[model samples]
Target: MCNTVKVSPRKLDPETRAALVDIAAKLLAEHGAEALSTRKIAAEAGTSTMAVYTHFGSMSGLVREMVHEGFARLERQFAKVRRTDDPVADMAVLGYAYRQNAKANSHLYAVMFGGQSLAGFSLTEEDRQYGRYTLLTVIDCATRCIEAGRFRQGDPRPIAHEMWIATHGVVNLELGGYLIDPANADRCYDGMLSSLLVGAGDEQRAVTASMAASKRRRRREVEVDPEPAEAVATRR
Candidate 1:
């Protein structure tokens, strides 16, 4: 008779140092940072409480790392945004990416910014700059459109802030599951963007011109790379 071999629950590699860090993050994600404790994390990881202190120094140390990691992820995501010559389109893409990230990582967002501060946890200057970078991406695009005679000549800073608020509203609602009909999201966003840009005749003209320039640029790029001869002939 052949005997069946029983497989063991893959014992999480017993690297106590890294194990504590990961366990702490998992606890923070499930329960807010305030609920996180060195003892709980160590117990969850199947290690002793002293292991956490030895690895992270204290609960505050663990929280600091968690906060830092959250911002770092946001920074990395924004950094990967492929730069395009058309700043407006780039801004739209960045905004969309921001919402997607927030939706996917709601726990990270709550831990990082939800006003429930853990003792000894504070946003570092670099952490704050991660947020600034996101805002700057929007402002840069708005400025480019204005300078190229697309958008009206006005300070882009306030406009960028307005865009952030509009995007944030949709994200907050969607994350809370308050927005059930997905179709309504696109309509709301489009309307908000249009209302934000609407202005005097001259400003409207500038906006139209900028959009035209962006389209022309895209067309020229496409023209530079012609389709395969066989594909074109097949269409005929």
Candidate 2:
């Protein structure tokens, strides 16, 4: 029998850990989840195969981290969105940011939702719940709108969820290149968000005019009046 060659574990640090995650994400996007073997990821990151085990314990552990990283990235993107005084307008900005992040990280976005690619990995309920925190940004906005007497009085989660569902569906289609005229996707996305805002009881005429003014003035990117996000990622 031939002797086995052992590789020493690479020194783990914040930078290295992040690099590994980024590399893994790229590999996942380029080759699909099945091709995300630890060996391949480590080699891409210029580390030994044992580094994966050292840093993340196992391939399954690394996949778990990948899911968490995707959600975490979204949280950070949405967190940067300016929460304008008008909760309805702010909600629209959040939707825009969501689409931007999805487009920028299309492959990771696909892997996050399309779990079929990683059929061999076993995910826990908690793992499935990892990204609920990001969804809360929508719910919190809906709550603000309701508190300001914009939406119908009730639990805001379901209503916000509908908005999220609509937004996600639109983004999914856009990313999948299903939009006939992708050039006009921005208009379509904005219009879709305006409709969702109206569905949540925002004044239809006001929302429409405000969105129009926003498009003209380009002041929509300035963040304002958003709820605190310090504890957002920690929430279930």
Candidate 3:
């Protein structure tokens, strides 16, 4: 799991390079992360297996790329939400977009933010920029809320961070199919957003709506997950 595998810098066109990674992501999404192999990815990308080595260094390098691209996808989605006079509404919409993107890209999301790195893959700081950028977008949205007098007057980073933490918990649980009712995604999701925004000065109405939905859900749930925290962390 290292990026130390070396080759000459690629001379392939950028499109071809992107194609390789794109094919790899699609394969991983469809077939699971363990399906990745230089030969298979190259075959799908219509390139020589050596291209993986030349362009990405190794399997681990490719995994790194997949992880980063997942966050890049998030950045692009959030970018599509236009700013508005109602920053609170804007933030709420962005939150919904975040969850939708997660649902749409579940497999990629699993690989990227999943609790563990792929075998033969290692993550470096550079691999984290896209994810970091997504966080920055959240902070930016929170900043807008504050400037619009929707949130408490203060640094938006912490506010953004709190929202992010809450968001991640729901996203992760949903990704694991731990939701009490899969069909109730919107309800739990809204609850989480409402819970986070309560601190931002939004009316508690969303909070009440979200909580009622949760209580209805918990009544039918059973405790089936027995995986230890460390195990979940290592292989999630």
Best by TM-score: 2
Q: Tell me the tens digit of each residue's lDDT in model 2 across 167-206.
A: 8988988987799999999888888878877877778897
Better of 1 and 2 by TM-score: 2
lDDT of 1: 0.59
RMSD of each: 12.8, 6.8, 10.5
Stretches of candidate 3 exceeding 4 Å from the true structure: 1-14, 29-33, 205-236
Count of backbone clashes for each model?
Answer: 2, 3, 1
What TM-score does prediction 1 earn?
A: 0.64
- Which candidate has the top score in lDDT? 2
Model 2 misplacement above 4 A: 1-10, 213-236
lDDT string, candidate 3, 115-220, tens digits? 5556567667777666777898889888987787667788999988888888778888887879889888877777667767886775687445534543443323
Off by over 4 Å in 1: 1-26, 32-34, 45-51, 54-56, 120-127, 180-183, 197-236
